[model samples]
Target chain A: EAGVAQSPRYKIIEKRQSVAFWCNPISGHATLYWYQQILGQGPKLLIQFQNNGVVDDSQLPKDRFSAERLKGVDSTLKIQPAKLEDSAVYLCASSRSGLGDSPLHFGNGTRLTVT
Target chain B: GESVGLHLPTLSVQEGDNSIINCAYSNSASDYFIWYKQESGKGPQFIIDIRSNMDKRQGQRVTVLLNKTVKHLSLQIAATQPGDSAVYFCAEKSRDSNYQLIWGAGTKLIIKP
Candidate 1:
């Protein structure tokens, strides 16, 4: 089975610029998630989508970050007016189902470097 | 305010020796836990998991032990190899947080030959 796929293995942008990351989850997966992982730190949840509908996004910075999973198969996370602090790896993951004991499958991630 | 944390930030062990990494969680209501191994430039991969009802679960050469009373979770790697070197993280599924998995900072395991 193919794994979760993410694009632009690495990205570089200037501060106050905009950047976007793309993700295509595994086949038949019902839940997708976006996480931001800083160097030397664990991943922090940014948003979650269950079949194109948001399940949770309380941690997402409403002022600068936004994500959408239209049609429920693919997702995109965007950061406008990026800050230096936003430099981190953005990971995408998927699960068979949002409920129960389904383990998450993660992609290699998009490493964003904001100068 | 609930959080998960590791006892050590880094651990070094000689190759072929057993390795143990520990984590502590503040939420008592969390019932499901998972262990993930993350290498440089890669995302976290699931290693093993154990539900609160089961104190122990074994997968291949890895073992997960959970202590509900102490709110502790541990991962034991037997006969560790250089390939086992990576950052290990423990996450818990909180019942109160809509079953969202709360992650720990992670413990870097270094295996020496």
Candidate 2:
């Protein structure tokens, strides 16, 4: 029962540069979500994946952000041409089931700092 | 359209004292609510949850009270500690599995030793 795992705990890049974050969810978990947490704000849902299928990504900026969960085990969120505003913690969470008080297990998150 | 938000942006409490954080929600359609605690450099961790049908739910050292009639939620911690020092957020969602969450702005809790 390991927790959700994420890569590159910290990242620093320049604005307009491309950056990508990876997430490996808990075993047997079907729902995976990517959220952006700006300083002093709650995490905003970017995209949600239910076993390789996109459930909701309405908040994802189609022009600059994209994510994929191939085969439904791991996921990657990419932010291209990153802007200063795009610099925030990218959190990856997973749940045992899709609904209820099942609770979302989160990783330490990748803190992206765009200069 | 519901906006989930906290009454305060930050709270400071002494160790061994109880802590009560408040939240106000605008969406009447939301039937589920949850409270999350987030520490620095980490993601939110679930503390407690309550459904609209139920007014209160209790957990170890924690309790969540839901007042759907007034669209409010509160998290009560019996004995606040240094470990409890983190930002708290209240999230609301519908019964449907696909419905997304509406999260509050969050309240930063500071514990005094």
Candidate 3:
């Protein structure tokens, strides 16, 4: 089966600019997640979606970051007025059951650089 | 894939030797554990998983050992190969968070030929 697909493997933008990333999870996956990974650190959960409804977004920077998983298939993450601190890899993952210990399938990720 | 700080923790082993990577999880209530391997420029790939009910589980040349008492987990690779070189991370999930996984920083594995 094809892994999660992400577009624009790399992106470079100036500070205060806005950017958006696209992700398509595996077929039949009910849970989708967005994570932010800085260099030398572990991936941090930005948001989690069960089907089309959000289950968790406590860690998300609501002031600048917003994400949505529409139709329970494709998802998008947006960052407005990007800051240098926002420069990091944006990862998208999905799981079959979205419950229990189901293994997560991850995409290569979209690398964002804020200048 | 890229690091801005000091290099990540590294464990180098000779080819054909057994390799052991250790991790300490934070939550005692975590019952499900998973080991993921990630190569440069790629996303993490699942290696093996072990539930708290069991102490050990093996897959291919990899084995995962869980110690609930100490909140520790280890991944053992037999006859490690160059292809096994990558960053390994351990993640844990607990019912309190609806089984959402909490990840550890990762260990970089280097194989010496």
Candidate 4:
């Protein structure tokens, strides 16, 4: 019954500095996702993982952004040399199945601010 | 005149009144739709969902209506309460099995006593 868990609810860093956010998905969920939500905009998918393997990461900024789901249970998204454009909230979610009627359970999210 | 955006960033409605939130999607292939509620300082929470097959789906006091022809989707909250106040967003899923859910800019709802 526990919801998705994320760490460091708030973070502030200077531009070019490195930062990372973490997520722990719901138990037994097969699908995990990381999204970037800007103020006044909908969330944009950054990367997706299915049991420690990647499913999609087309939108991810390969130059700086990277994500990993090592054990298939927890994930970490990192942005090296962070930029002002990366100040949006980072959200991690999970679903029982990758398709069908399953709804995503999200964590509180980490709010990153780059100066 | 319909900008797929509200004239104001926030809306205040009296309790017990009906609340309607609207969204416009650009992709015609977006066949699956959902509505999510996000409280202040928290991630979004799922409210209701509807597919291209059906025009409407009801859950508790919430209703989701999809108009594929106009590329519009709306969420209706009956007898709205203070607890219902939050940012509402509508998401669309492509027909492909990529599991990608595209989203709309959020609309913030404010409830008054």
Q: State which candidate has the highest DockQ.
A: 1
Q: What is the full ranking by lDDT, best candidate first?
A: 1, 2, 3, 4
Candidate 3 off by > 4 Å: B1-8
Pick by lDDT: 3 or 4, better one: 3
Q: What TM-score results for chain B in every one of the models?
A: 0.98, 0.94, 0.91, 0.87
DockQ winner between 3 and 4, please give it: 3
The model with the greater TM-score, 1 or 2, is 1
Best by lDDT: 1
Error of 3 at A96 (Å): 1.1
lDDT of each: 0.94, 0.90, 0.88, 0.85
User: lDDT by residue for model 4 over A54-112, one digit each (tens)?
Assistant: 98999999999999999889999999989998999999999987774567878989999
Tens digits of per-residue lDDT, candidate 3, B65-92, equal 9887867789999999999999988887
| Docking quality category of candidate 2 according to DockQ thresholds | medium
lDDT of 2 by residue, A6-102 (tens): 9889999999999999999999999999999999998899998999999899899989999999999999999998999988999999987667556
- lDDT score at residue B87, model 1, on the 0-100 scale: 99
lDDT tens readout by residue for model 3, A1-115: 9999997799999999999999999999999999998875678899999999999999999999999988999999999989999999999999996677798989999999999
- All candidates in order of DockQ, best leading: 1, 3, 2, 4
Say what the interface RMSD of candidate 3 is: 0.9
Model 3 scores a TM of: 0.94
